[model samples]
Target: MTKKFVTLDDFLGTHFIYTYDNGWEYEWYAKNDHTVDYRIHGGMVAGRWVKDQQADIVMLVPGVYKVTWTEPTGTDVALDFMPNDNKMHGTIFFPKWVEEHPEITVTFQNEHIDLMEESREKYETYPKLVVPEFASITYVGEAGQNNESVINEAPYDGMTDDIRAGRYFDDNYQRIRK
Candidate 1:
């Protein structure tokens, strides 16, 4: 299929619910061209409504699209929506640990999280899969049901750096010691 990237106007007034393999279900409402409101169904922030989160939505195929955004805590997310197949797959990059250690520069070999063999020779590194591609999530319901709640609410400003660092821990060290 030819690649075509469409604008968010195509998705405006749409609502989608997807459940990850890890059992994290999320409800996404496309309010406009730049803003999306989301609610986590099962996670640390469950039931917490994040309103007016800025997002970049692009159509990859006729009915498939890729939506991406960065959270306030420095987390990056990229999700591919496959409505025809009733599936959504994506990856979330948690940069809290890396942010704590500004001295290190982390680079991934690919979206699969494999480390490059050449990089090992250049620097002392313990390669880890920081970005894990999530399994396909089941997409439910039709779009344009107006599932919108009280929109125009305050946008989501994720956790503060220090607090987020405390909650985020890697195998090496905890960034911020409470």
Candidate 2:
């Protein structure tokens, strides 16, 4: 991850252009010095490497999002994206571990994620399979609609307005723990 800490922006409930480029990572080390430099192999064209990216507005909220990817061998996965203060926390629920005891769940902070090889390969491979896919967020509202202003309602406990009402759900969308 480039940044040690990721401060959450206003992307809580708003869907906007989210872009990323993946390429061969090259780290150059000086012959006598340990200092290194990194670059993308095919990152530029002519004199510039136009990075590949997919831009789409993403409304990330605390809830379960289904993963429909190609790769017939790969199983399904769900993500629970939670926004706390300036951090977006996520819990990955792999299909194989959903039913297994001591579920093999992966939890990490989004701010600390790098589109490069820093994060899980799934983060890069899965999304690339589909373009402009709507990432359904679990926002609790009156009639199936959620807004940014509403946080910590049903499955999520808001850190900002002291609105710790309703019970919270785990990464697998289970209310096992409050």
Candidate 3:
């Protein structure tokens, strides 16, 4: 039998964020060739430790994710998340111990920041309650090297295609409010 790989959306959409009392911890590189301990909080992405680069993106997806971390004192930290509130949050805790690392540079990636700004602009223009008809769903799955599943889905019912397509905003236009 061939193993089937499911798209992130399909796998996550059906799940719920699991929780635990024990915190999770992991090592991440500091700017100065030092390692910092990160604590995982509850109500956020699971399995992945806090301060993990991929954890941020995992939270953005529409699904439940959980995370756990163990502190220096041996206390456990946990985080849970639901798909709806995932994108609303960013990096959680950045400990002072890790800040001393000279090799670690804490900063947002240019591409991610740009995409976030664009999403904010669209959200402001169309209230969160109103799902735009032109909103596209990014398919993370790949069928082949050249082809992927990314495509835009139709906007809300009764909205015209033109309206949906017209509402599309360019990434360059969104200014970082902060």
Best-fitting candidate, scored by lDDT: 1
What is candidate 3's lDDT per residue for 51-107, written digit by digit as tens? Answer: 222222133233543444433212233334333432211223433322233122222
**Model 3 — TM-score against the truth?**
0.21
lDDT of 1 by residue, 136-175 (tens): 4333322342334322222233422222233422333223
| Model 2 lDDT tens row, 85-127 | 2122222222322223111121111222252223234332332
Error of 1 at 155 (Å): 16
Q: Runs in model 1 with CA error above 4 Å?
A: 1-10, 97-178
- For model 3, how many clashes? 32
- Off-target runs (Cα >4 Å) in candidate 2 are 1-108, 115-140, 143-146, 150-178
> How close to the true structure is residue 150 of candidate 1, measured as C-alpha lDDT?
25
Each model's lDDT comes to: 0.50, 0.22, 0.25
How are the candidates ranked when ordered by lDDT, highest leading?
A: 1, 3, 2
* CA shift of 2, model 3, Å: 24
